[model samples]
Target: MASLFQRRRNKATQVERVRERRHEGFLRYAGFRWAKISASLCLLVIVSYALVDVTPRHNGGSWYGYTLGTIGAGLILWLTALGYRKRKMTSDHWSLKAWTSAHVYLGLSLIVIGTWHTGFQLGWNVHTLAWALMMLVILSGLYGVVVYATLPAALSNNRDEMTQMQMLEAIRAFDRQLHTAAQPLTPEDTAPVLAALDEDPFAGGIGARLSGRYPDCATAAAHRALSASRSSDAEAREKVVGLLSQKQAALGRLRQHLRIRALLEIWLYVHVPLTFALIAALSAHIVSVFFYW
Candidate 1:
């Protein structure tokens, strides 16, 4: 309806707007289209379970139960495919963001499908074992999703735009300062200060890092000793104590960095292996059923 020049202007504006649009994260990718689809799928399974009638008491051997089982197995395979899909890079329709969104929602929907497949039956058998493992896998994945969504922002805030190495270097710099400040103090006082200066901030394993609890920390121990003792050289002792406090602050930041990093990473250690184990158990359940039946 517009003139030629106005049409050209509108086209240019549209291009510019598209260029300036914010990048969509995995959760909101495609306007959470996958989430709504997954929700509908779960609702469908639940409603079908309510409506379907099976003879000789409903159980995993029933027709509806088998249908749900097949769907759950296929969904599990697709959900696991995200691990492989993430390794490839592409900006086309099947982007990593799209894959991740599907993995999360569909993985969650498995809770309903897998449970309904059992028809609320439980026992000490391979079938129930598989169900328990599937629950574990989904629970671990949900933990990953929760931490991934919230912890990155907290990590960035804690880092204050600095890289990991930069934070470590800052701690080392404080250690050097502590060493220099302790030079004028007497041996009795300098002993604790030197211990603080030589303390390693990154000396702990995953347990120590995640727990954020280091009772045997040398720097902390030294600080307590220094604060409790009264030395002859008050000036030098005060300087040493101040440096120890500074070193403690640096170590605290370092430990916090480690804590957040561990929280972000620890889930994968549990999530990935449990997933394969779950699939294996599910397979065994299937094989045992057909073999024994």
Candidate 2:
């Protein structure tokens, strides 16, 4: 009886393992198919552009520009459809890794098609504005790509699966430990510890955060003060200094975490506004082209 039960349990586990494998295979196939279809369509548009001759129209317009723009717009529409389809399908289909790969490669292709559509012309008009906005969107997207590709790995290695708040909490715990360790020090030696605790962590403005030059970082100031303080017991003073060094190290880690987060967020500011502007400019450009012709 015991042997029969064990065999049944193993069989059930094997079935579950097979199911999981099948699910993963399905996901891989879906992702590959999506990428393949989008890529093939893009290639087809490129080939059509090459085969179909578009002569330049007079009066500040060209058949080439209109043709390229129409094809580019179609690709953009298809890409947008894929995004919507992925969202509707399931979360796994829109994984960050897959979305990022699509975003970067497809976005680069947009730059090529959009520039060609402009025919390298720039002026004080809606067309120029549309072109500029598209460039800004592409540049901001590139920034996001770089940050996502590099910083997430760095953040993972630095944090080891811990959340940002958890990392900050750990740093604070270390600070508390240091505070306890410094408890035995004399008043003269304890001044820096007090100063560090009193310091404002969020006093810097946006510029200071971006530039990484905190003018009012009390931790550094306290360390300097501690180093210069004349103490009667050299041994105790050295111990306090050691604790201050550890505090500085902890503070540095906290600042690094903040910097990485800031880098991740900064590009969105450029991207979102440029996207809105692109929409408005594109609308005007389209209307002008059709209405005037």
Model 1 worst lDDT window (10 residues)? 17-26
- The regions of model 1 sitting more than 4 angstroms off are 1-22
Give per-residue CA lDDT, model 2, range 4-123, as digits (tens). Answer: 999999999999987764454321444555456556756865676566655652112577677777866665555444335555534464654455456556666777677767756768
Q: lDDT by residue for model 1 over 1-293, one digit each (tens)?
A: 46988999999999886664336678887779899999999999888777777887678888888889899988888888887898999977788888888888888898999998998999999899999999999999999999999999888888888888988898888888878777877788778777766777888777899999898898888888877878637787777778778878777877888899999999999999998899899999999878976
Candidate 2: segments with Cα more than 4 A from true spot: 1-60, 76-100, 160-162, 174-192
> What C-alpha lDDT does candidate 1 achieve relative to the native structure?
0.85
Question: For model 2, how big is the CA root-mean-square deviation?
Answer: 5.9
Q: Candidate 1 clashing pairs?
A: none
* Top candidate (lDDT): 1
